[model samples]
Target: MTPDLFGRHRAVLPDWLALYYEDPLEITHGEGRHVWDAAGNKYLDFFGGILTTMTAHALPEVAKAVGEQAGRILHSSTLYLNRPMVELAERVACLSGIPDARVFFTTSGTEANDTALLLATAYRRSNTILAMRNSYHGRSFSAVGVTGNRGWSPTSLSPLQTLYVHGGVRTRGPYAHLDDREFTDACVDDLKDLLGHTRAPAALIAEPVQGVGGFTSPPDGLYAAFREVLHERDILWIADEVQTGWGRTGEHFWGWQAHGQNGPPDIVTFAKGIGNGMSVGGVVARAEIMNCLDANSISTFGGTQVTMAAGLANLAYLLEHDLQGNARRVGGLLLERLRAVAARVPHVREVRGRGLMIGVELTRPGSDEAAPEAASAVLEEARAGGLLIGKGGGHDTSALRIAPPMSLTVAEAEEGAAILERALRSV
Candidate 1:
């Protein structure tokens, strides 16, 4: 391919495709917490390729593993078993605190979520699934059906059954506050009312920490209440940890730990960081629920040798380096620094999140409504200053998501925060 060929093609691409190319930097390479654009300019990568490159780009261990695996065997039909697949599943199960958990792998987060939803529906023999408002599961038909966001309205894949519930509104500033007992109770009451009026749901799917919906944390006791309700209804709880798992939250290996919930969920979906940017996603389900599906339902590319090798190497890197612990320490420092910066910048409505999954809410100086345009401006300014950031939240898009690699150092965190502060000031 010619050097200009890709750029020329991108220029003529439809607007629908153009939306995916909004990033100011055209990345050619990356390492640790930095990336180089096509122009050879280096930029600090705070977004981590939408929070998927946990170990950073071109990690030596992961690349080496992928290379070795590719040299030996690249693909294997699902009908046949592979050593890498078995090792990957064993490692994921061991880290997930579910030793006997059966894993169903896929090529992306959406596929993993779709598989989990399928299992939930099949096992319960029910058509309806209750999902939280503002939650983002994935783009597949079933995933989108349960995704509370209305922006995915034009999807054609229809689900057997789907229901919506008001999870909780943003209670405090840019952050959704679920810290109080009353707030927790009110959320539970709302869920109860929704269930009372609708058919019993086959499963309840939720992001342990809302990733796309402004990085909101659930109410203090909300998860426990949710568990109780779902158990009472005999419905499974599907924890969609695509964005919040693999120690991104710092304290725990998963975001569910921050919720203080009891026991593990029946089904958990993971992607993004699991393979450190390699195309790998999977459902870690309770053995019983996993057995509900026949082998014929599996994906051909799921758990491919190459992807499995990458996943294994990524996990080994995370554990050996104690990246989770680093995330916690650096995340706390970043939050503290961000809070200070927010206090000075009137446009910054709030700073919220756990560990490295932080969000900065932007609004007009004295306005209550989200200033999505202002947020976009800030993002642009940050990009010009050599930092890559991302926007999240509902349609408002007023929340700036900061999810650096787990390998990010305190110095890098400070540098990213400094760029953000400068952006806010310039805006």
Candidate 2:
């Protein structure tokens, strides 16, 4: 980015809104998985605008759908009947696996999570919520209140009382040394013990794969074991799939499916990828819980024609092309390559994630201590090497996030992995 543009951005935008690079690039336009900066430097976009571009950059199908819909009507109130909205909702309800599923649209993931919190608290008749450590829900007051990551949680004041739990991260925390089964059992035991000491909370909200927590996740069926306990107490299980949804996780269509023995989560909140860059977020729940609200509420521009049209097209393209399978095949290859690279690099603590959503944690040269500075150096090096990635961790922000578009080809993956390998070693 030019100094003038950077100075203008700092002068206008909030300081809390973070930028990626020391000299942040103003992206001019993009196509496929490549984006060009204002300097006309093209970089392979591995971050996919923080995983919002689930399909590809400037996809023709999505653009055509948005253009057609915009040519007709731009905005429509939620009070009126909307064909595109209803159609997209039907698709979502069918895809959502929740029986008697009802979909409520919101403009962003934060709003979707807010709606989920409202329904859970209203139905369960408790303002208490259970969340996992190092989890990120969103930025709104209600969303941030439940967030367990101190870097993301800005305020201590909140309307709901929240309790933090274990089992989100597998290789950290006190149980990191245990095997998968013993680790899971220990987390479940901890949960059971916690519930014994407190009132029944409204719900347990967790990202099946902790996105911002360096893509760390517990052993499979851990949630199912927890569900066995929560179900006995009538505590709802809510899966926050904002970053892990839309087949990005490769092995599972939904991140929660890795622990599917207990059946689907009672409530699921999603956003960030369904519209392929358009603002689309929603909550899916069973009819009883969704209809438990006493008063009417509507999202003014939640299901606008333009956004829904783009969602429908993107969903169709994603499904028809079987991008999920592509992610599995190509992402498996990429993960192995990055792991091989990590094996040769000492700064890398671990490389973990499934499918397109991967994270490489960095530590100090010869210590286990978190290295935020090393992470920043890798980001700058990766950008200079013509690649764009992201970083996030519990508090120190020492993990490199690599989630490209689902349609990323094997060639692109190889290219990105090479760039990333160079960045990791160079840093």
Candidate 3:
């Protein structure tokens, strides 16, 4: 049965589209943290569909809201009044730190980033963009152009003249040997030198934690230091919070708050988890910049009422239950457990991340060389043990990514960690 489905998929889908596992299972349904494959195998989901299922799978409140909204109205273009869309925008604007903030919704993170690029370029009057090394923003042309990771970026041609900068992944770069303070100082110096060498860029776009780059991050205030340099030159700062937003990191509501010395960013783009599992993405920026586009514009299916309704319900649930606090508490415990598990594993290179967004990088024993084979082995073993996880990294995809739902419980964390420990040991 799996082979027949795989054959059909390969015949219809693009070859570049990738799937997990040696024999991929068709996930039939999910409830809370557990999902059942077509073969009637139940597995605990740790990756949460690339962190898109922020709250949980089949959340009753979100499902009810979506159903109700769909029954009344499916979609209404930007030409008409959309109450749900307006309400969600207002809520997001109030939460966004940007002063005089305005929100624009899109259908996916890629479109949100595309809109951000459009706004930054139009506002600053330059097509040049600054991005970090080993970053993965999206799959769009503009997003790919700015991506410093060669694995995800398939083409060199781009509409924007993107200049890749230093200091996204601190452990693998030239300044990895330095202490945290020295690392930030070196990255700042590099940024200043790069600025001096190039034309004034429209914006510097970056992910707070490079999700696909093994969840790697720099020192907390590194971006704040760079912000000081960018501010002097009137270059905009664009934060791509698709994977790091909505308190996924546990410590802060927004990842940028970790580097809040320079105040809020000029523009912020978000998607993935905002709508729980629904398709909702958007950009929030000061009105002056959001309205900088001279020509009139509208996203045809961007803020359809159904998706907005789902988003509103999901956001309300997250806030009312204080899921951010839950994430901090549970994710803290989970990180400690994973760190303990990593210590006994010979190939585990590093265990890092905040809150629920954790990463365990696998490398050759006693060396920094990435061990992609070990990662693949662990992934397959975890599945055999009834636990589902994710794999990603710029260094040959050797990191095990474990970003479960924000509402994960302590018991679930322990259960998942036990399974992961066995998987690690087996490899």
Candidate 4:
């Protein structure tokens, strides 16, 4: 049954739309942290649909809000007053740390980032933009133009003159051997050198943690040190928090707070968890930057009533239940357990992440070269053992990504870790 459906999918869908596994299983339904395939196999969901399911699967609050809102009105233009949209916006603005922050909703992260580019370029009146190497923002033309990852970026022709900056990854770069302080200083010097050689860029955009680059991150406070240089030149700072926002990291609500010594970014783009399963994405900027556009603009389906209701409910549940605190405690235990497991496996290169967003990098045994085949083997083994995980990285997709829902519990973590241990051993 699954194979027949897979054949149909391949026939209808674009080849570029990637699918996992030798035989992709159909996920029929889910509850809590578990899901069942059409063949009656139950698997522990660790990836959470690329971390889109921030809360538990089939969460009652989100389902109830979505159903209730649909019963009333689903489609309403942004021209009218939207109570749910306003409420959700107010909550996000208050939590954003940007003074007088304003929110504009979009259907996806790509559009949110596209809106940010429009604002920063118009405000600074410059077409030059700076983005971190080994980073991915989105798939749209403007967003792809700034993406520096060669695997994901297909074209170099762009409307904005883009300059790739260094220091997104601390473990595999020219400055990898440096200590934390030295690494930060080296990245800052590199930024200064790059700035001197190029025109004044409108803004410097970066992911607090490079999501598609296998959850890689720079040394702490690296962005803060660079912020000083951009500030002096009047260039804006935009934090792409699509994967790092809403307390997914153990220590902070937003990933930029990891470099809080520099204060808030001029603009922030967020998606992928705000609405749980619903599509909710947006940009938050100070009124000056958000309102810099002289002409009118409205998203046709950006902030419809249904999605706003889902966002409001999900955000409220996340805060009221203190899922951030849950992520910190559970994530710590899971990380320690995975580290112990990796120590026994010679092919496991490194285990790195702040909270639930963990990555286990694989390499050929006794060599530094990436072992993408080992990653694929582990993924297949984990699936056979009733576990679902993900894989991605800059080096031929050699990193195993494990990001469960923020509401993951101690028992579930232990269960997933045990399955992962066996999978690694099999690999």
lDDT of each: 0.83, 0.93, 0.93, 0.92
Give the Å error, residue 104, model 3: 0.4
Q: What C-alpha lDDT does candidate 4 achieve relative to the native structure?
A: 0.92
What is the TM-score (0 to 1) of candidate 3?
0.99
Pairs with backbone N, CA or C atoms under 3 Å apart (clashes), candidate 3: none
Give me the displacement of residue 49 in model 3, in angstroms. 0.6
Higher lDDT: candidate 1 or 3?
Answer: 3
Could you give candidate 4's per-residue lDDT for residues 173-252 as a string of tens digits? 79999999999999999999999998899999999998888889998898898899999999999999999999998788
Task: Point out where model 4 deviates above 4 Å.
Answer: none
Cα-based lDDT at residue 196, candidate 3:
92
Model 3: how far is 225 from its true place, Å? 0.6
Candidate 1, which segments miss by more than 4 Å at Cα? 1-7, 10-14, 18-24, 172-179
User: What are the root-mean-square deviations of the candidates from the true structure over C-alphas?
Assistant: 2.5, 0.8, 0.8, 0.9
Instruction: State in Å the error of residue 238, model 2.
Output: 0.6
**Cα deviation of 169, candidate 4, in Å:** 0.6
TM-score of each: 0.94, 0.99, 0.99, 0.99
Better of 1 and 4 by lDDT: 4
Candidate 4's displacement at residue 329, Å, is 0.7
Which 10-residue window in model 2 sums to the lowest lDDT?
A: 209-218
